[model samples]
Every structure is written in structure tokens, then in C-alpha cells.
Target chain A: MKFVGCIAILAALAGTALATEIPQADRRSGYSFMGPDSRAMQDDDTSNPGMLWVLDGETLWKRKAGTAGKACGDCHSDARVSMKGVAARYPTFDKALGKPVDLEGRINLCRSNHQQAPPLAYESRELLALTAYVAQQSRGMPIEVGNDPDLAPFVAKGHELFTRRQGQLNLACANCHDDNWDRKLAGAPITQGQPTGYPLYRLEWQSLGSLQRRLRACITGIRAQAYEYGSPELVELEAYLMSRARGMKLETPAVRP
Target chain B: MARPVLIALLATAAFAACGPAGAEGLLPYTVAGDAVPDSLTGTKGDATRGRALIVERSSTCILCHSGPFPEQAFQGDLAPNLSGSGSRWSEGQLRLRLVDASHFDPATIMPSYYRIDGLTRVGNAWRDKPILSAEQIEDIVAYLVTLRD
Candidate 1:
């Protein structure tokens, strides 16, 4: 009994010796990564490169397409009113398909099912333009997804994927983004990695991209075999990211380093 | 006959596929600043080469590590500082951490440079290959040992 007590004491001391801590009040956005110049670029309606895509998307919204000759505007007119709060609730579970679908998937679904137009390829210029435009409508609104009962399973799966370790590096998304966020890496601030401003312009890619693109970058960074666009793992992971950003103001077309 | 058992096995397999599972059974080693098995060419390590590799993006050591390198312009703060690291741990300890920090702490963010087992989703081009050669590990260890007050 004495020996066991001594061992337990030593174990407690060892735990104290490790300086790791799960910080309280760990709120930070990807905007924390940018400098004044980058922030200015994002806020400025004229200078922001994302606005250029937004403009193109606005044009696509009005232009008629598909064999049915229907524009996105024909059914859902004035996206400012129709698309409000829509982008904030993405990666939601699709009851019809029994899977989680992101804004991109919904966009493609509309094109195929309702618009009678060919689906734009993932990560394409056209797709990004449309996604950014739609997301911009929900700007300043808080993310409100994951409340539906059908989405609970995907949300739980997303939580598992977020916390579970992966790749050759044996890292979970939570390890860095959760544990070590508000820190710096290679001069760039490591925010909590919220996906609020996705389809937002990234200086690294020098182009507009999707949330899946950023996720792919992280997977590749860890030397993992990245899944192709629209993989189940990616969607589940996206669901978790959206959930994490719940109640946070959406910042579509936001800029990042 | 064993229908439930088969279902259980399949469930286990599916669950395992969902996350990265590092190798089973820890590699045994002595602690307290002992000698590491020298796999790098049995030659003196070059600290200069080691420093070069650590800062390079391809090495990716700087992604989550901040060493005693101010001139490099940027470093990560996720891991412990490498500055003055020699005084904190022995050469063997440092070597072990480089080879596989997971051996010490399973949840460590540090990658196992010399380990190939138990890793998931490795690219086809680099499957079965270690991230760093034994020589590179030696070089990094040498450079890290030079960090002092």
C-alpha cells in the first residue's frame, strides 16, 4: 500500500511537470492570420479579389443556362433576400441522399435537378464564383447548422473525425487548431481554423477555393493521401468545422494569408 | 456459427479505417540520456546541414516548432522551443524525440521521422519510406544540441 501510494504521488507530479494546458476562452478567427494589408483587402469592396469572383457570380445568377433555359435568378430572385442565412447552414444532412451536403453540393444539385444545366466541376472557377456569391449573402449572420435531428449522426461523425488522430504525423485537427491556436507558425498566426470565410480568397493559392480545398491542403501537409473532392470524410469534417463556428458571424469572401 | 463475431470484427475494421492508428506495441528503449543506436553514417554530424534542413519548408520542422532561429523569419509555436533544448534533455532523449516523439507522448504533435509503421494514408510515392534519413536525424540532433544559454 505504501509503494502504491508513492507511485501515485509520482504520477501526479509527472502530470504537473508537463506544461500543456487546455486554454479557456480560446476564441479566434482565421482573420487573426491577416495583417493590416490583408484585412484591408478583405474589407474593401473594390480591392478584394473575392469581390471579382462575386461579381462574376452575380452575372451567372442572372444569365440563363441549361436545356430548360432557366437562370438561378429565375427561381430564387434577389439572392440578397433569398440567400440570407442560407450559406451559414451548409454541410447539412441531405435526407434525400442520406448524406451531408455542402453549399457546393447543393449548388451542383440545383444545376442538375432544377436548373437542367450541367453540374460545374468541383473547384472550378464557375463553381467558386457561385459559391462565393451565395455565401456573401449570409455575411454577418452567425452559422446555425447542425440543429436538425437528421444531421446529428453526421455531426457526431464530424466530431469524431475532428478529434481523431490521422496521417503519418498522427495528428487530429484538434491538436493544432484547438490545442495550439492563437500561436504563430512560420510567421502566420494559427487561428482556430474556422471555415467561416470559405470560398474566401487565399493568398497562398492566389485564387478562390472551397473549404474542401483548404482541408485537402492540411491533409497533404500531414503527408496523408488526400481524398478527392466531395469525399464522405471531407464532408463529415466540413460538418464539424461548420459546427465549431456555430454562432460566429459568417465572413464569406474573407481574405487570408 | 460465429455470425456475431464476424459482425464485431467488421465493425472494428470499419472504425479503425476512420482514424489514423499508429503502430501497435511501443518500440523499447532506455531513458535517462542513454546512447541511441547510430543509424546515420557513423561519421561526425554537421550542424550547418542540420540547421539548413530545419528551416526549409520541405523539412517542415518549422511548421510547428520554434527553434533558436530568429534569422529564418518565421517559426511555429505549437511545439516546445528548440532553443536551449540541449540543456533540457540528453542527446539520446533528443534523438528519441526526433525518431518518434510519440514513444514519449502518444498524443505529441511531433511526427516520427524514422517510423513507417502504424501511419495511415501515406502517399504511394513515399509509402514504406521514412520522412528523414538517419543522417538527417543525426544532423538535426547535432544542431539542436548546440542550443544553449
Candidate 2:
């Protein structure tokens, strides 16, 4: 059955190759500069409030956020060294719940167990920026998740969710993004499924957001019931994305259009 | 019944005439009048130049599309394949797309590469000129037309 599926996919690819003639100029794929809209909005100043959160995070790194009075710095210091490559391993499986967990969940975990602070709200600039800064520390690191034995089930679940069709359109994330990626749908250029960069600045959103937020947008585009912030489905999906981008270098806070 | 049939035939003829060719020619960027020609000749276009333009950090075309090209390991799968776009579309049609596809489809999110009236919302100093020059467009068109298999 798997061999049949593979043959079918190959036949479809061959048919498509014969059906459409791609332009040579358009075939040169890879990274490109931000479009006009994205270039204009980029904040060159590292001192911008968003960037300033890193300084605050630096403070919060040492100062306790919870009633326990135990600071993040108390447990983990030298973020440059300790947190190095940490962000790239996130959205991993949690043995306690037997499910995947994202960076936000991990942060909240620290808030409850260590610093004892209230969990930061979703879309909060402070939370987003702090997450951004921490993730930025792991820039250039390759994604490495789901290697543990207990993580296998969650990774498999994530892969299933990545390709499963859902929503009103009966379309999976792979449909428009993977299958029809080079075709002009209404006129917008389709991009490949790359999740190595997050906390990205988008022209359409006009702000920095997490990869989960972007996934939610895709879900909405297909007219599906959006998974709530911090939902299990989103965490699983993130795990799948991280796996797909296993070897790609992290480009946190990347600008996009 | 005869009068209605005559009207329908006339309407169909008018529509066919105004289809694509009747639309305005390619618009100019910096120079006055239409700097873009109806057809290109000479060196045609350098595929090497087109390749660099597609991958340049400022163009944003590669953000959505993917191809079999060697350098694009990070290519996305969200848009249509561009491996043989030249054969599918005419040079004039390609020119229109580069200028302003929104004229054909209002809801299109693609930006107008060239607009001489003014690019107010883009940037402070940014003008109506396209990121690539007319000659560059010719080069890209020439390169695109060559994709066969």
C-alpha cells in the first residue's frame, strides 16, 4: 500500500510537470529580500521597546516573577551559554502529559514552579518580546526535537495532523502550501513550509508574532474552527514544524511579507 | 429574437477585441513615456541576472514559491511552481503582471512592481520605479521563455 501511494504521488508529479511550464526566471528559488512593505516597517534600532524587553528579560532573568522568590537567574544564569540552543529544541513532548509543549507552556511552567508569577497572557507584547529575545539567543542553532523515546508518539501524531485534511475547505496545511505552492492563487505568491524562523515580523500582520499565531491564521484561512491559544493541537503542529525544519538554521525575529 | 441575436454577436466581438491586447502598454519608471518596448531583442535577457534577482533579499518572490533550482534549499511550497511560466503566459501578459495585477483582480495581494503615479504607502523616499529596471524585466522575460522541460 505504501509503495502504491508512492507510485501515485510520482505519477501525479509527472503529470503536473507535463501540464505546467514553469518560467526559468521563477525557478531560481531560495531566500530573497523583503518586499517594499516589509522593508519600510523594519525597526533598525535595537533599542526599540520590543528590543528593550530583552533588557527587561535580562532583569527578569535574575528577578523572581513568582511568589516563591526563586528567580530564573537563580536556576539558570548566563543565558548566552545556558540557554544556548535551548530555543531550537522546544515544542517537544512532555512526559508528564504525554503530549507536546511549546515555548509559552515552558515559560508558564517556570512561572508556576519556580518564579511563581502569573502566566503571561497571549499576544502580550512583553511576553512576545521576552520570548523573542530568548529565542533569539538560540539563533543559528538547528532544530532538534522529538529524539527521546517517549516523544515518538507525539511526533507521529504531529505528522498526522500536518497532512490531515480539515476545516470547511477540506484542505490540509499541505494542500495549498505544499501541493499548489507555485501556482498563483488569486495572485499571491505561495511559499514553502518553512518554520525555522519565528517571532517573525510580517508585512500583513504589521507586527512580530509566534509560529503558532501564523498556524492559527492558516487554519482561519481554510475556515476551520481555530484552535485556542496554547491548545494541544497547536503544540503538536509546532512539533511537526520543528521536525520538518530540523537542519535549517534558526532565524528568529525574521522579517517577512 | 433576430434583434437580440445581433446584439449578442456584437457584444461578443467587442469583448474579444478588448480582451488583453487592447489594454494599455507597459508603463515607464524613471524616464518619460513608455520606456518598455512591445517586444525585446538583442542580448534578450541574462538568466544569470534573473537568477540573482529572484534570490535577492529585497525581491520577496521566493518567499511564496518553489522550484527545482539548485540554490533554493529553503524554498516554500505555498505558491505555484514557476518552472515554465514563460510558455504559459505571453510577454505582454507577463508585463501586465509585473506592473499591476490588481487591475485584473482587485483582491490580489501581490504588490505593483512599477507605478509611476506614486508609491505613497511604501516608504518615505521610495518612488514609483520598480525594484528592477525595464531592461531587467526584458532579461527576466527572456530567461523565463527558455524553460521548456
Candidate 3:
């Protein structure tokens, strides 16, 4: 049922996040954003479309790579145990690279350094499979990222961007997630825009997607120029979102509206 | 940026209003039962044509808004029903709501149908132009004004 119906009007006015105090309710996970049916879809792994990607990722995990022709399984060996908590701990601070790296970034690093394979293009089918597969291991684990002192600067930058409003719409991420997390927009419920369910399946897409894709959609929804994939701003925003959702459970391959 | 430069940059960009003032500068634009007086430029609006535009993919009001029609499929739930909007808002208020609803609610998902400034990620083809033209806004407004029960 629509909140504002055919006869019952008086649609609730959108409020400024700046004026409103951030409610503790805003800390809710993305699961709150979904409808009952979607939650059911997520509850049953067999029905979840993201499982399709996970299955492929499982295959790729064991498949060999270039030059050395090493599969991800060769080095990591038994993702069920070895890859445990890996997704939860990203975007990790890379001491040598001197920046935080997301799950996908770490996967690429492993490919070039160990497998000697060229990096996969962002959002490629194989990349999505591998990411969904890898992230599946950490499913149900609490996100434990953005804790390192080395990641402080990047996390701070993410905060800046989250609050910064821009575009013709003049909206910031915080406007929805912080000010109206429990409020309904149009008919859709708003969540804190948490990153806990990324590399997740969205029924809207009918396919698996990376966190960057979701971020891009949000930017476009606000009518702002989306940062390019792998851009510093997007990466920093990812780190910040992960930090924001520090204690939320990772629902990789999550089903969403 | 390093601390000093970062602070300087934030100072300049943060406090600045997202969009620049129109020809009127920073004064809030007026909303009422009529078209924006000076900016309207006297283009006559036709309700007949406005009716066509509402469902047209170009104007796309129906993409998110449902009623005020018998012929078109009762569609989307993203916005309020337009069936009795004329009874709810004054003609001037309707005009202003379409021109730029954001002025009232900063976080409204409703697009500024007739605003162009402070926009990013706009396609190259439609850069610097509002979604609906001045006459089109008047046309839609004309049509909606007649919908009063």
C-alpha cells in the first residue's frame, strides 16, 4: 500500500538532515530497507539470485590463472576457512600501498602479485562472481573494517563526502540515511544506507553488483556526477561506509528492492 | 590535500549554497496561484497539450505519479496522486511546486522540473536546461488547475 494514497494526500514533507538530529534508529542495517518478500528471498539461499554468482565464484576460486596458472584456491586453499573474515576486514589498510583497500581491490592485488594474472575490469562478470564467492565466506560476520589508525585519514575523507551535498537535487548521503532512516520516502522505506550488504544481489538488478554500482546509482538518483569506478573519492566513501556500518552483519549477496 | 589547504578548500565549498541565485540573486522565489510573474514571460499554456505531456515519456510525470487520469494506466507510487492536486494547492503553489519543489523540502525526491543550476551528472545533450520549458510548466499547471473536484 502506498503511504500517500489516491485520496489520502498530505504527503510527508522531506526534511533537512542538517536540522534534524541523527536518531539511534538511523543505525539500522539495509535489511530494514527491504520489504517482507525481499527479506524472505534473502532468508532462503536457494531462492536468492545472488547465489548464482556465488556458485560461479566457487568455480573461479579453483580455476587456474595466467603465467603461473594458479587458482585462488591454490594459495588461499579452502575459502571456507582461509577466506573467513577476509571480507569483513576490508576495506583494509594496505601498509605498502599506503591506502585502504576494499575486498575487490585486495582480490585484484592477489591476482597481479601472486597469480600473475591481469586485473579483471571493475564490475566484470568474473569479478562479480569472485567477489560474491569471497564475500559469501564472511556472510553473517560483523563488519570489522576501518579500525586501523592508518585508515583514519581516508575514513575522515569519507565523512566529509557523506555530508557534502551537491547536484541539482542538493542532496547528501546523510540526508536520507541520517535524517530519515526510519522515514518513508514516497512509498519506499529509508535505511541508514549502510554498506553491510554490498557485493549484494538486488532484485531491481536481477543480478549481483559491487558496492560501487550501488554508490553510482545513489549519486545518479541525487542527480550528481558519479565518481569514476576506482576513483579516490569512491574508495574513500566505501571505507567510510564500511566504518559507519562497523558492527552490522555482512549480508553479501543480499536481496534488496 | 594537506591540512591547511584542505581546511581552505572546505571553507570555500562547504558554506556556499549548492546552487547559484537566478537572475533574482539570493532572494527566495515566490510561489502562488499564478506563474512566476516576470520569469513567466507571457507564454499562454494549453491544458489540452499539457494532458498529453503528463503521460509522455519526455515529461514523464506518470512515471512516478499515479492518477488524475482515466485513460492512462494507474501507475507508479513514487509520488502523490495528482487526481485532486488542484483542490489541494493553489495554482500559484502548483506552479512553484513544479518549478522547484526542493525550495520547500531540501530532501524531496521530486525533481526540480524547471530548474537547472547546481546540477551534476546531467547528460551532455540537456546540459543547463530545465526538464520542462516555461510554456510546458504553464501547460501542465493549466491542466492540473482544472483537476479540482
DockQ top scorer: 1
Return the candidate ranking by lDDT, descending.
1, 3, 2
State in Å the error of residue A19, model 2: 20
What is the CAPRI rating of model 2's predicted complex?
incorrect
B15-81, model 3: which lDDT tens digit per residue? Answer: 2533235422222333433444322424457889988888785575775677767676545465788
- Residue A6 Cα positional deviation in candidate 2, in Å, after optimal superposition: 18
Interface RMS for model 2:
14.8
Q: lDDT per model, in order? A: 0.79, 0.61, 0.76
Query: Would candidate 3 be rated incorrect, acceptable, medium or high by CAPRI criteria?
Result: incorrect
Better of 2 and 3 by lDDT: 3
Model 2: per-residue Cα lDDT at residue B95: 58
Candidate 1's iRMSD: 4.1
- TM-scores computed on chain B for all candidates: 0.73, 0.62, 0.74
Model 2 bad stretches (over 4 Å): A1-33, A36-56, B1-149
Encode model 3's per-residue lDDT on A1-257: one tens digit a residue: 57557224333333233445344344777887677898999889999888998999999999999788899999889999998888988888899999888888888999999999999988999999999999989999999876799998999998888877755555678877776566545335667788887788887887788999998888876657888888888889999888878878899888888
Sort the predicted structures by TM-score, highest score first.
1, 3, 2
For all predicted structures, in order, the TM-scores are: 0.84, 0.54, 0.77
Report the lDDT tens digits of candidate 1 across residue range B1-149: 58657645654554365312453332222333334544234445788999998998878799878877878877887778788988887777778788777666555677888777877778665677677776788898888888886
Where does candidate 1 clash, by residue pair? B23-B118
Candidate 2 residue-wise lDDT, B1-149, digit = tens: 78657645654564465423422232222211222334322236677787677665456556555654666655544456668777777656665565555455432334545443322222222333455555676666666666655
